[model samples]
Target: MTTPSERAARGREARKRVPRSSHGRWIPSAQRPDPLVVLEREAQDRLPELVPLRYGRMAVSAFAFLRGSAAVMAADLAAQRHTGLTVQLCGDAHLLNFGVYASPERTLLFDVNDFDETLPGPFEWDVKRLAASVAVAAFQNGSTKAKAHRAALVATESYRTTMRSLAKLGELDVWYQRIAADDLLPLVRGDERARVADRIARARRRTSLQAFNKLTETDASGARRIVEDPPLLERIPDIDRVTLGKIFSDYRSSLPEERRLLLDRYRYVDAARKVVGVGSVGTRCFVLLLEGRDDGDPLMLQIKEAGRSVLEPYLPATAYDHQGRRVVCGQRLTQAASDIFLGWMTGPEQRHFYWRQLRDMKGSAEVETMSPDTLRTYARLCGRALARAHARSGDRIAIAGYLGTSDVFDRAVADFSLAYAGQNADDYAALGAAIAAGMVTAAPGA
Candidate 1:
């Protein structure tokens, strides 16, 4: 392994090869693919009936469009020059992707919660995606262009400062660092701290029992089962008890020995196909309700089908053959504390799938209704979290040296984010046009 001093020297040299100001540039490729065409390609493998729903969600707003267009951005980012400083990336690191969830120890921890498009890629790609999301979200919330740009700047600066701080820490120290609820409240004051506290309180109530009570009930046969709601949550056709038993057995075997033993105590009750999130709307996702010792004791798990990451084409090939294992391994690598039940398996037809708690106190910032002050604070927190995640897998000293003790890179990223935010609006408009032309079928705001 290279010494920290040597890494710093290499990072400084990297600055000369790709100056910070160059990061601000966003020249679209002359042959850039149509956004609608890219969306069509992405939907080809998805469920035909649910593809329209994905378009419906993305049609909501430019910010929504940006959220669902990870593949489009990945293609664009691939066209840009990079510093070659790579990390295990959350390919879709939008503001909404950072959330508070329970760690293995049941402690409240805030970190990146989505890993659908995760892969090893240039560190700035993640930072730039995050900054741009802040700008786009602010604009969607009726903030001025200046305020939107400021949010991006705040996010970039926070990431830079956090990376620099991490560079000075020992490897193990940096690896062990985490942003729990207790560690975060002290960083803010008054309303900001109160907001964090409220979010924490709400997250505490969002558990398996809460979900079970709200989504399942005792049927006429005296057996508890999940309720079905058409178009969103419905039972798969022809799937019976024998098939479910096998599925659960395979999933249980995928877990760690201890976790498998723990899961063995529970009996599967019901499963419903559930649609979730903007980007994941068309993917095959299911909610499984399990009963432990009694009807009051319940556990809910999500079994979501995993496809190739958006970054797969641009980044080096992943070592894992199963996409479910790719998502699980990537989540474990980036998060300091991951879900204890997190595991993956391959289903029929070679489809990869991963399982985890359906909702374990998962709470995200309500970006749509955030005040400018709250947005800025949230952006900073996201930056800090992203920096720590990158530092765990990438060379922190090198990245910090490249950024230096200045705001040049920060301002550059802000500028890039603002530019990309505009492009997102244009892309959203194009999607609307496609729907109008009958080229894409959607329910608009569904």
Candidate 2:
């Protein structure tokens, strides 16, 4: 293993290769592919009927467009030079992606919750994505351009400061780092504390029993079954039951021996097809309902289709051949603690899927309606959470050294965020234009 001095030197060397100030640049290249074409390609593997819904969601606003178009940004980031320092990226680290969730230990923690696009790549790519999303959100929420830039800067600055702090810690301590729920409110204001507390309470109430009550009902025969909300949540037909058994068996086998025993305690009650996420609408997603010792005990697990990462084409080939395993591995490495049921399996059509609890106190902030102060504070929270995650998978010493004790990197990223926010607006309008021109059909409000 290299000494800390070498790692620090390595980080500084990367600066000479790619100047920190160069990060602020964002002029779309002449050869840049059309954003619509990129979205079209992404939709190819998705459910055809839901394609329009994805487009509709992306057309909602510039920030929504930024959330759904990770591939477009991946391609754009690929075109730019970056610090060679790399880490497991939260492939789509938008404002909404950071949230509060329950750890296996039953402690509430704030962390990066989405991992559909997770992959190893240059560290700055995730930072840029996070910063750009903040800028887009600020604009959408009616913040002035200057206020937006300040919010974006706060995010990058928090990231830089957090990474630097982590670099001074011991290896095990850094690995064990997590931003607990208690750390959140102090970052926000006094009156807003109630709103923040209310969100947490709501998240705590989002349990399997709550989902059971809301999503299922007893039939004439007294058997409980999932209610069908056609297109969004549909019952698995009789013909697919046998295939479902095979899928369950495979998923169970993928778990650890102890987890396999834990799996054995629960009997599968029902399963249903479900649509989820703005960008992942068309993917094959399913909610599995299981019963424990009695009628009072319930567990909900979500199995979402995992495809090749959007970052895959831009970065070097990922080591894992299975996309589901790639996502699971990235999450395991980057998260402070992972869900007990997290596993991957191959289904009937050979599509890869990863499993996790449907709801374990999972909740996100209301970004669209946030005041400028709340948004900036929230931006800093996301930035710090993201840095904690990056430090887990990358060399904090090198990353911190490259970042140095200056705001140069932070300010440069903030500038890039504003410029890219403009580009995102243009792309958002382009999608709206395409829908108007009948180039693509959009389902009304999905």
Candidate 3:
């Protein structure tokens, strides 16, 4: 194996190919595709009736637009050169995607929770997406441009510093690194600590039992079932329910022998087609309710369709034949710890699907409600989580060397984030205009 110095030298050499400072530039090319067209094309295979809801949700705000337009940003990032440091990317690394979730060990951990568009590619791409999100979120929350830029800077600086620290560790030490939820409280200042603790408390309460109480109720016959909330949550048809029931077995087969036995103890109860996430509005997603031990015990699993990663068009082809497996594998590789129920299967018409707990202590920040200081603190924490994630799959020493002992990369990414936030705002307006002109459809407030 090469020494740490050799790896560091290699990373420094990459600067010659794509200077870290060059990341600040964000001149939209005249050839850039229309944002609406890009979104529509990317979502062509989705359920047609629900497409309008996606557009409506995305129209909520400029930050909402950014959240839903991962493909749009992917295309833009592809237009520019990138550092060749490869890592399993959380293709949509916006601030909200990094949150608290329960690991298999029942330990709460802070890490990247979403992986809908995961794939291996250049490391800086994820950093740019994160920085851009921090800036957009800060601006939407009413922060000044300078404050927004500083918030974005905090994210990248935290990432750089975290990566540098991880680089000094041994192999197993780096592999075992994780940011525990309990450890987060001490990091926050006076008033923020209580708020952070409350969020964690809320997440712990957001279990299958909480979902069982909120989502299900007794019918006249005394059978409990999921309540329909129109366009957002609807009970699946009996036939569709049967199809998912069969697919559940296939998903179970993907798990380890022990997990399969653990799964067999629960009997399938009920299911619903549920809408989730800003960008994932129109995807084929369903929730399966299962009962174990007694009627009081419940487990909620989500089976979501998996399509090609948005980055696939620009980066290398994924090695997995099944897209669902790609998502499962990527999630397993990047997360410090993964959900116990994680698995993948092929559904009808050969569509790909991955299953995981619908709500295993999952909690995300309410970015719009955060004060500027709180946002800055949260942004830095997310940055640290992301760096730990990347170090698991990439060359930490090289990444640390590329970042160096200065804040140059952080400042450059912050500048890019601010510049791209302007591009995102213009695109958001264009989307609204399309809806008004009858070129696009939207079901506002859905």
Q: What ranking emerges by lDDT with the best candidate at the front? A: 2, 3, 1
lDDT of 3 by residue, 138-206 (tens): 999999999999999999999999999999999999999998999989878888889889999999998
Query: lDDT of model 1 at residue 220?
Result: 98
lDDT of 3: 0.92
Count: clashes, candidate 3: 0
* lDDT (10s digit) by residue, model 2, range 151-245: 99999999999999999999899999998886787877787988999898899899889999999998899988999997889998653668867
Runs in model 2 with CA error above 4 Å?
Answer: 239-242
Query: What is residue 161's positional error in candidate 3, in angstroms?
Result: 0.6
Instruction: Give the Cα error of residue 289 in candidate 1, in Å.
Output: 0.9
**What is candidate 1's lDDT per residue for 111-157, written digit by digit as tens?**
99899888988999999999999999999999999999999999999
lDDT of each: 0.90, 0.92, 0.92
Candidate number with the higher lDDT (1 or 2): 2
Tell me how candidate 2 scores on lDDT: 0.92
For candidate 2, what is the TM-score?
A: 0.98
Clash totals, every prediction: 0, 0, 0
Tell me the TM-score of each prediction against the true structure: 0.97, 0.98, 0.97
RMSD of 3: 1.4
